[model samples]
Target: MKNISLRAGRFLTLGLVLTGLGLGSCKKDDTTTVYGNWTQDASISAPRSESVSFVINNVAYVGTGRNPAALSTNNVYGDFYALDPSKTGSGWSSVTPMPAAAGVRYGAAAFAINNKGYVCGGYGYVGTSTNITYLSDVWEFDPATSTGSTVGSWRKVANSLPTPLSGAVAGSIGNVGFVGCGFDGTGNTNIFYQFDGTTWRTLTNTYPGQPRSGAMSFVVNNQLYVVGGTNNNVATTDVYAYSTTSGWALKHYLRNVSNSTESYDYSAVSRSLGVGFTVNDKGYIAVGGSTLTTCYEYNYADDTWTLKNPFNGSARNNAVAFGIGNYGYVGLGYTGATRLNDFYRFAPNDAQQ
Candidate 1:
């Protein structure tokens, strides 16, 4: 009887050890699987594209996109919605619209500085094609007051450079805003400009990539990167980086591992015409034509591109994306024939997959 009891104890110990080993293996696999993926958290009702979205104080604000019905009409939306990621259930609420009706302008650029959000440079119409205007105007909105004062309103910044341009990508470091390559109403340009809150200065270094529109640009590690865009509807897979002292240089070419010939084009979407941002030291590209929901991530450390889970909400193009913390917010844009108002949050996790 004593011998039987000893055998039973040993069996129980062996079973527990095996169970622990199994669980450990499972956890390891899960962690590895989800290391670089984005999971959809909450969806908000935000319909419109060619709009702008940005995050301030852990909450996101989305507003001003083209109206769904009259695609050509320059009716800018004034409705402002706020998103709180920490809140459960419904996470978005309407705050206040802009003071006046701005016009419908796709490809406008937006960025935040000192907690204030600025919307700048896009094409819109006052009445006709003759009246169809490209604006170099800039507007400032403060989330704290939930108010917009076009008080300092539209100032023409680029005097020495080309005429009013749209589809320009912009990124801000400190109080300085950098605008790079885009369409100047007639053709794509490689011009680079910097705005020091009060004035604009054109940088002499020309970007090496082909003159293209709709490319994505972002700054990582104090270096600016421009990725896939279109040259007259021809999509490019080239990626370039620029530094203040070094000028523009090629980083890596994004090649389609699945197809050597296939390339990304007008499909590339930036926060503006050419905008990109860094999250977790990895760069994420969201929203583009041809492949709307498609999302790609770049590991700067490895210089490799990995296709992550596609954006879970409406597949769209010409939308805007901004990062607040661990999550990235995307909203507004055209999904094929229809304009979208839905908002989505992408959360990157380290937990087991």
Candidate 2:
């Protein structure tokens, strides 16, 4: 062989190229997969949705939902249950009910503030007729005492929004709670309001997604994400986010898939229903209808949507979900013509890629 001279920089460049290609190949082989499906952690003796759920100190408390009639009359259930996922024994046990039966309401909202849970808004039978009364009232529940008292009842706080509205999405970041985008009985709304324990103030800026009702919302990394809901039962895949300074920005559109079957009908016949929770800066949405057993997740860093494993329970919609640390709980809803009172939990290994 003839004598060959090699440049030092050229040799380093060749080494880097080979290393990069090898890493890229490894990443390409790492396909995303669903690790955990739904598991029956604890079954409530009674089932309810359109009710409220919140977690404090790794314990989940669920209460309130409509009865089987699909009518608000006799729909209110005051009884509550406490679930300890860490325990191996019977998961959920009965706790105190609300002092009085809450309004016969469905599609209400709930959040925890100062270790206390607050429940607000939903349809109820104030009279004999079904009315979309958005409750301005708020109730406080203490997990330590295992009791709830209506302390922060719907008082007119400073700069309160127009009229009481229901089907609105509510969530909290830090000490502030946000309520945005829903119906006022007659029409969809794009208004945004914030509550700081004592008062409510409307943000001048509004979200970009089409005004909708029954959408699900959660906060991660101090940013709020709102996903999937209906405009007259017209489900939408549009997702939006709000930050401290950046009011609202369109993130991505959710897509539905059936075991690798992809579809872009986010606004198809699916009903604008409820079921969402936050996990490790990501938000997961579960169960909504006109159809059931559907699930999806939103990644905040990339602003991308990924269809996850479908719920393994009865296919249904109009249910609610809450996250306690890494565990997710889903329960209660109308499954086509019938109403269901069952609940399930989803646990995924956060360490695995």
TM-score per candidate, chains pooled? 0.73, 0.77
User: Candidate 1: RMSD over Cα atoms?
Assistant: 11.2
Q: What is the C-alpha RMSD of each candidate to the true structure, in Å?
A: 11.2, 10.0
Which is the leading candidate under lDDT? 2
Residue 51, model 2: lDDT of: 69
lDDT by residue for model 1 over 175-242, one digit each (tens)? 66677677887788878777666566787787777877788866666677788877877777778877
Which regions in candidate 2 have their CA more than 4 angstroms from the true location?
Answer: 1-32, 70-72, 125-134, 146-162, 255-271, 350-353
Whole-structure CA lDDT of model 2: 0.65
Residue ranges of candidate 1 with Cα displaced over 4 Å: 1-46, 72-75, 87-90, 101-104, 126-130, 146-162, 256-275, 350-353
The sequence of per-residue lDDT tens digits that candidate 2 reaches over residues 1-353 is: 11212111112344446777884234343234444457765667765556677766677777767777655456566556777777877677776665443444555566776776666655564434456365555556665662344221222233434445677888888777777787776688878777776667787776777888888887877888887787866767777788878777875355443233322333322336757887666787777765666565656775544555667688776776778767778877777666676777776443212
Question: Backbone collision count in every prediction?
Answer: 13, 0
Best by TM-score: 2
lDDT of 1: 0.61
